[model samples]
Target chain A: MNIIETVSLALRSLRSNNLRTFLSVLGVMVGVGAVISVISVGMSAQAEIARNISDLGTNIVSVLPNFRDSASQSRLLQMMNVGLGREMLEAVPALSSVSAVAQVEATLAVGGDTARATLMGVEPSYSKIIPTDTAFGRWLVIADLSVHSQVIVLSSSIASELFRGIDPVGKQVWVTAGERRRPFVVVGVTEAEEDEPASGAGRQAFIPVTTMVYRLLPARNVSMYLGQTRSASDTDAAVAQLRRFLSLKSVDPDAFEVSSQQALLDAMKKVTIIVTSMLTVIAGISLVVSGLGIMNTLLTAVAERTREIGVRKSLGARNDDIRAQFLVESVVLSSLGGMAGMALGYAGSMAVSKALNWPPAFNWLSVVTAMGFSTLIGLAFGVYPATRASSMDPVTALRCE
Target chain B: MLKLERIVKDYDAGDIHVRALGGIDLHVTRGDYLAIMGPSGSGKSTLMHIMGCLDRPTSGSYLLNGRDVSRMNDAALARIRNREIGFVFQQFNLLPRETLQANVEVPLMYAGLGARQRHRMSADALRRMGILDRAHHRPSEVSGGQRQRAAIARALVNSPSLVLADEPTGNLDSRTGREILDILDSLNSEGVTVIVVTHDSEVGRRARRIINLKDGLIDSVEAAADEHH
Candidate 1:
């Protein structure tokens, strides 16, 4: 028989046993639903991480001091433990690719509001290399260093809390050392960064590097330094260049670590992809079971319709016709079940995304993949049953009660 | 024309070799109305099944239209059954889920006709069987005679040259049985070869030729009065 007639007949038979049909289709639906939901969760999480990291500017690299040790040692001893220095900062300019550099200490501060802020000792090129600018005033510069000027730039939070609505630039602020106090002019107030859960370390103050080294923190030392590159992709090469420069200057091969922002992001992506793949594979198990359910159902269907087989055979249906009819019926059922499951999966994933407030990820590839898998299930499951039915002897089938 | 030459069919029922047909030779030309009669286990049904290409003879050649069909494979036999032979089972064998029209349309469906052709042909066949008014009704909704008539319509749907009825009247009351017999008689008169297998001698006496089977062998062949259409 032709496809249309075969399908109609199959549909009629299925409808006659509506409960069985529903039960069979339910297996596929659940399988698809599980797969889609899992994929969506993975996609949404990936997007969220990517957006969060990219928002922090992938070109900006933060240098944290390898300070697992105590901070009370002498300058020479701190230098011995300290990894990076002026050699690294000066070599950044030679890379032609390294846009700017800044060295910072965590000890220097402004009082009554003396807090442990990253006291950056930067050049005027720091503004050119990165995009840092004062919201209310100006930052320290080379001119201040030339005069050994006692000028500093407050972070937006410290300036607001200490200076209290006053533009701190050109205002005198107290910088205290042991048994002595000096007045330093606040030349700038840096802008406060947008708060994010992932980047909570964006607040800091700027000072002339010469002044910071000679005037303040002379007892401790400059340990950590930050670098910026012309492009996000250049960070790796710039880090390599800086590492080579610093190692040559320090004569210590393993003194410091040069980590790039892109490398970190790539690592995160790799880890996430691995997790997502594992999840997808785990969900695939349910799909395979669903396919097996379809096969079992078709097998039972062939057994139940033996006499129907006889009737059709006697009515001029060839063995191939019988085979085609059963095969097509199976495909139709599976494809329809696949479509419904896809719809269910879509809705379920969307609901999960909404309930979790995650970024939505509706993967058409996943849907198509699900459909292909489900169709395969039908084919794999239906083949044996169709072949068995086709192989039935017409005479014996007619004689079957 | 159909011919059975020394047909033999045997089955090994456990330890015993039960013979269903034994050296039974018979012949009938086109448009012949023949009845096969036997008591239970007498092999009359086996003879009908072999005649309809539903079964193969063990050691004999059965010819249809001058071709040996006994040695044909199952698929080839099914093809001949589809195009050249039509069957009416004792149980009517109507697909209960299908409407009368759809039931009659099955053979034409197997003919690979398009939807329009199958529908038209089925309607025409149902009309000839005088059940056109109930074409949309399911077999469960129709009477026994109507169901048998639907079966006859389905059998003729492909316009087969021969109709095989295996105890066609067995499931019906006397009136419905007579109604079905009359339809078969009329179809034979219209140049369709008709073979009816029955255990009732009363039914067998209605055919133009009666072949009696006993102990798997042909016991007798007697000519009877021609059935009037």
Candidate 2:
């Protein structure tokens, strides 16, 4: 018999009993839907995290001090004790590949504004090394350094809060320390990042490292930090130079922790990828369960049609022909269920994307895998029932109730 | 032509060997109308089963058209049953779920005939039985006589050489049974071998030859040349 005829006959049989077929296909629908929903959420979350991390510049490296001091000192004083001082910053620029250096911390004033901001201390090359866009006035110039200019750059949030929507450029602000503190002129105002760290958003300030070390916080020691790199290919060279210089200055490499932003981002993505793949595999187990449901249904079908089997056998249908008929029926049912499930999965993914406000993207590989899985399920589950039906004896089957 | 030589069919009922057929000799030529008569448990049905190749004789050689069919496999027997013999059971064994036309098409379906040819043959067979208009009606919707006629139509649809009727009229009324017997009489006269197994003497006496079996053995063989046919 032709496959078309067999499929039609099988479909007709299934159609004759609508509730049973629907319940059977329902298993596949739920399995495919679960798989789609999980993969979509994982992929979207991964993409979002990767984008957020990459927004930080890839070439930049951060150096945080290992603060270990006696309890008698304040926390800020202890932090200052762990820092690499002005000697390291002065030594870095003389090296051929060293690009720029900057360091930042908080100094709070309760009089004019209660908010505390990062008190950045940097050299003239800080603007050139980092891609900080100036919104108003000018960046710190070389003339400022020659004239010993004690000038500060106010970030947008600090400018708005401290100056009350007025441009704070050219304004003199006193950043008070214990006894000796000086007034610094605000030369420029830089645009603030929207998603700045919670600790760095309220009061804006910047000045020369020489001025900050000599003037404000004179009682506490502050560190000199490096934040720059060479070209992409020279990244390793820059890191090696810094390591060698730090080793020459300090007794142990454990005195500081050095990390690259790009390395951190890559590591996070790798971990997320592994987690997503594991979740996908767990979802795949449902498909296998759906296949088992199809097998059970087909086995029951054989049992119910014993008399029909006998009639067909007595009429001279070959064993292969009987097997083929039942097998064709099973495959057709499973394929139909698969097709329905794929459609449902597509719709489900689209719904999730709408809910999450992410771009809607369909994975065709998922459809292919679903189809292949359904076909295999049909074949694997259909074999036992087909064999049982074909192996029945005409005499005993005819006598069956 | 068909021949059964000293057929013996023994059934093992636990430890006892109950003989269903005992050294029975029978011969049937082309276009013969023969009836085997016996009461219940007289082994008339067993003999019919052996003659139709649906069952095997324990120690007999069955020759169909001079070909030994006694040792044939089940598949070979099925092929022979589909091609060379037609059976009409006491219950008028039409498929209850199929339409009359589809029921008549069953034999041709196993014959590997194309759909169009099978349909045409089934419709023609129904028309011969004068139930062509009831072709689309299921067996449950049709009368007992109509169902039996439809069964007879299906039996003859393959144009087999022999028609084995095992109590064909047992489920029909007397009038309907006479009508069916008339159909069988006409089929026999048209050169088809007909073997009717009946307990009714009136139905048995209509055949050209009657063989009476008792206790799994042939009690007597009588030739009634003055039958209706």
Candidate 3:
């Protein structure tokens, strides 16, 4: 018979035993569904990580004091005294710009309202390194730093809170820490970055580092230095140069830590790969089990249909015809299961994405791979049963009950 | 025309080799109606299987329309079965899940007929068998006589040169058995070669020629009077 007739015949037989067909294909469906859902979640997570890293500025690197262990905490604190200031960082040939920031937790009082906030002391170039744009007024400039101006940039939410629907630019706010009240002029309001954690959005305020050291907190030391490389490709070289320079001046060379967005992304990708592979291996086992299910089901079918096979053989069905019919039945079963599993996986991913507030990503490569694998499983597992059916002796089969 | 010379068939039951058919010779021509009669274990079924090209004899020469098929491979035998032989089993071995029309289309399907043509030919066969009204009914859904008619339609659907029926009415009532025999008689009268294998003397008496097999050899050949036809 033609392929269409053969397939229809197989389908008719399957339909006669609908529940068996469904049960036989369930293993494959669940296996494919698990694989597709896991891959999609991994892809979306990878995309989110990439987006967060890019928001941190691809060419920028942060140098922090490494708090390796509580035993070395005192030594680390002492090593932090070694100056890795803007001039020293900018003098590195690989770096294009540098900014040093020192932060303190303080209460700010503006227009009879008080709110807790992180007060950051930063240079003018800090805006360039971290890449934030002001929603109103202007950013701190070089002259502000040279003059040691007590000028501040408030985030959008803070500006709204302090100004109460009025423009906070050019207004003065009081920053108090332990009864030490200092007045700083709001020069700019920075826009809130999208997709930031709700806790970090409006709690930060930036002021000139010179102003912070001279007026706000004279005892607080620089907390971290942020630098931008001349080119994205030069970030590693810049980080290496800064590390070497800091190590030479510090008593504890291991206390200095430098990291870039690319480094963080690489580390995150490694973890993602491991997680995805582990999930895929688990799904692969299910697929193999499902293949075994197909074999068992087909073998049973062959045994049950021995007399039918005899009748067909007597009616002139060639060995290949019988073999083809069974093979087509198996492949059709698995491919249909794969398609259904894809739909289930997509719906599952969407539900998970909604619950987790993440964007659902549909990975086509995984879909194709899963489908192809299932089809191959059908072919691989269907062979023995189909061959058994085809090779039956007509006389003996006719005698079968 | 068909010819079988010195047909011998053997079966190995463990280490013991049992001979099913020993040195049988037979010839049949177009429009001939013959019956092969024997008790159980007389190798009648083996001879019928060999004649239908379902099994190859241990030593024989079978020629159908001048083509030697004794040494043919499985695929070649299948082709010969498709185009040259039609079989009706006593059990009415129709696919239980298929409608009568589809049951009749089995041989035509293997003959590689197109769907529309196969459908038309199967319908015609069923119509000729006087069961066209029940073409869409499954085998289990039909009566024994109707199911046998469907089986006969299946045998004739391919317009094969030889129609081989093994105890065609073995499971039917006396009336249904007589009806099936009358259909076979009409088919033989219409110039279609027909062979029926049965152990019943009454069934054997309906054919124009009866070959009674004793053990693995033919005991007698008799000409039965065609009184009913």
Question: Can you give the DockQ of every candidate in the order shown?
Answer: 0.74, 0.32, 0.81
Candidate number achieving the greatest DockQ relative to the actual structure: 3
Ranking by TM-score: 3, 1, 2
Residue A350 local lDDT, model 2: 82
> For residues A1-401, could you state the per-residue lDDT of candidate 3 as single tens digits?
77777788889988888888998788789878888888888887777777778878789888888877886765555444214575556468898878878888877789798777788888888889888799899988889888888888988777777778899988999998654788888999989766433343338888888777667765546777888898889989888887787777665677778888889888998898889888888888888888899898889899999999999999999999999988988888888778887887788777777787776788899899889988998899999999999999998999999
Q: On a 0 to 1 TM-score scale, where does candidate 1 land against the true structure?
A: 0.85
Candidate 2: tens digits of C-alpha lDDT, residues A177-220: 44655677778888777755434454446676555655555544
The 10-residue segment with the lowest total lDDT in model 1 chain B: B220-229
Off by over 4 Å in 3: A67-83, A88-90, A110-113, A147-149, A166-183, A195-202, A211-220, A240-255, B15-17, B225-229
Query: Comparing candidate 2 with candidate 3, which one achieves the higher DockQ?
Result: 3
Q: What is the DockQ of candidate 1?
A: 0.74
Return whichever of 2 and 3 wins on lDDT.
Answer: 3
Error of 1 at A103 (Å): 10
Q: How far is candidate 2 from the true structure (C-alpha RMSD, Å)?
A: 5.9
Tell me how far the alpha carbon of residue A160 in candidate 3 is from the true structure, in angstroms, after superposition: 3.5
| Candidate 1 per-residue lDDT over residues A1-401, each given as its tens digit | 65676788778877877887877788887787778777877888788778777765677554433433354223224553122444455567533322223344353344445544566766665665556778866766668867667887877776776767866778777765444455778878777766512212445767766566567654435544556676776777777786776566545544556676677778888888899889888888888888787787788888888998988888867788888877877777777788888888889888878887778998888898888888888788888899999988788888788
Chain A, candidate 1, TM-score of 0.75
Task: Looking at model 1, give its docking quality level.
Answer: medium
